[model samples]
Target: MDVLVVGDANPDLVLRGDVRPRFGQAEQLLTGADLVLGGSAAITAAGCARLGLDTLLLTALGDDVFGVITRQRLEERGVTLLLQPSGDVPTGLSVILTPPGDDRAILTLPGTIPALRPEDVTDAHLSAARHVHVASLYLQPRLAAGLAGVFARARALGVGTSLDTNWDPTEKWESITDILAYTDVFLPNANELRAVTGSTDVDRAAASLVATGTTVVMKNGAAGARAWWPGGECSAPGRPVDVVDTTGAGDSFNAGFLAGRLAGLPIPEAIGWAATAGSLSTRASGGTAAQATRAELA
Candidate 1:
């Protein structure tokens, strides 16, 4: 496997078109809705597989209808699954409401997500893949608890590592400070960078993270992304595309950038690829459907 992705696995129940809630006894209609395979890690693995990498997805699922759908989609995308079904807990789920301007409000149910253990993420898995990507750090409590040890083990095995510590539900934004030092590729949105570093300024926040020897890629959606190293930084302008849905676009961007780096592309070219990959993914409602392959990227 070229990349090993570790995180939650779930199906996204997406509701599009001005969605709103009604009172206790009332119900509203939605213009569109679909059940699709989604999760930051799953999307990244699908993106990498589509871009021609041998991708391995390490996560847990449940023996349910949603899990079946998730597994099918991942397999169709050529991702080798190292997933197990838990009899006790149901699979995770996300209910997304996408309104105008590609904005989304998400309600996530963490079922089997918190059950993922660092022990399952074996050192052999780390040795096989050239790179390992961990997503949605804050969602999985068990995984996040041992992330530093897992990441440290990956590094000790000479495997490259990346982390997309998605929104912290608890709002505490803890544990990332130590793990950042073990991360080779750290992807965070502008807001996350600020929240994690407790800085009102982007430059200062990025610097705080960069000083840990991790290359920080700050995602700014419409403004594209910026990458900062020890003493240098570069920005990639956003790709102009008709936005359909922004869900998982950042995960797709991480996939593109990591793919570029693994392929030995220059930083500028890699960020360009990431911007394009992310923008193009918005052409469809879900994350994986519109992802471009390596041939398409060319």
Candidate 2:
């Protein structure tokens, strides 16, 4: 495998147009509703595969309809799976309420999202891959607790490691510093960077993380992306696109950036690839619906 992605795997129920709910036994009509593959790890893996990387995803999934759908979608996107069955719990699910704007709301039922543990990532898994990427850290408390050790092991095995924490539902961003010490790349959006570093300024937040020797790559929505390392920093402007949905765009960006790095591209060029991949993914509703292929990115 060229890349190994470890984290949550589930389906997303996306609803658009007039998605806000009203009380008092009232019902409203929606413009569209679609069930699609979700989870940050899954999306990132799918994106990497689409970008021509041999990708493997290690995640937990229940033997439920959602799990089956997730599996099928990932396979269709060319991502190999290393699934851990979620015992009696149903597969996780997220209901994304996308209004007629960029901002949206997500209500998640974390049935099996927290099932992955550190022990699940064995030595063989790290040795088989050139790079390892972890996602949705807050969703898996057990895995998060041991991620530092996992990354350390990957590093020891001569594998590069990256992390995308997604969002912290509890709003308490904890246990990140230890992991950064072992992480090669730290991927986070602007808001998440601020929340994690407790800094209102993006430069300060990125600097704080980069000080730990991990390269900090930040996603800034329409503003594109920026990267900061020990001795240098660079940025890429956002590509202009008619965005239909912003779901999973950042994950695609992560894939593009990693793909460029694995292919020996410089930071500035990798950031350009990241921005292009993220912009192209918004051409459709779900995260994987309009993900760019390697040729498209080229």
Candidate 1, 151-263: lDDT as tens digits: 99999999999999998989898778778879998889988888889999999998888888988888888888898987789999888887778888998898889889889
Off by over 4 Å in 1: none
CA lDDT, candidate 1, residue 247: 80
Stretch of 10 with least lDDT, candidate 1: 97-106
Give the per-residue lDDT digits (tens) of candidate 2, residues 43-143. 99999999999999999999889988999999998999998868999999999999987789999999999999999999999999999999999999999
**Candidate 2, poorest ten consecutive residues by summed lDDT:** 289-298
User: TM-score per candidate, in order?
Assistant: 0.96, 0.98
lDDT for 207 in candidate 1 is 88
RMSD of 2: 1.0
- Which lDDT values do the candidates have, in the order given? 0.87, 0.93
Collision pairs in model 2: none
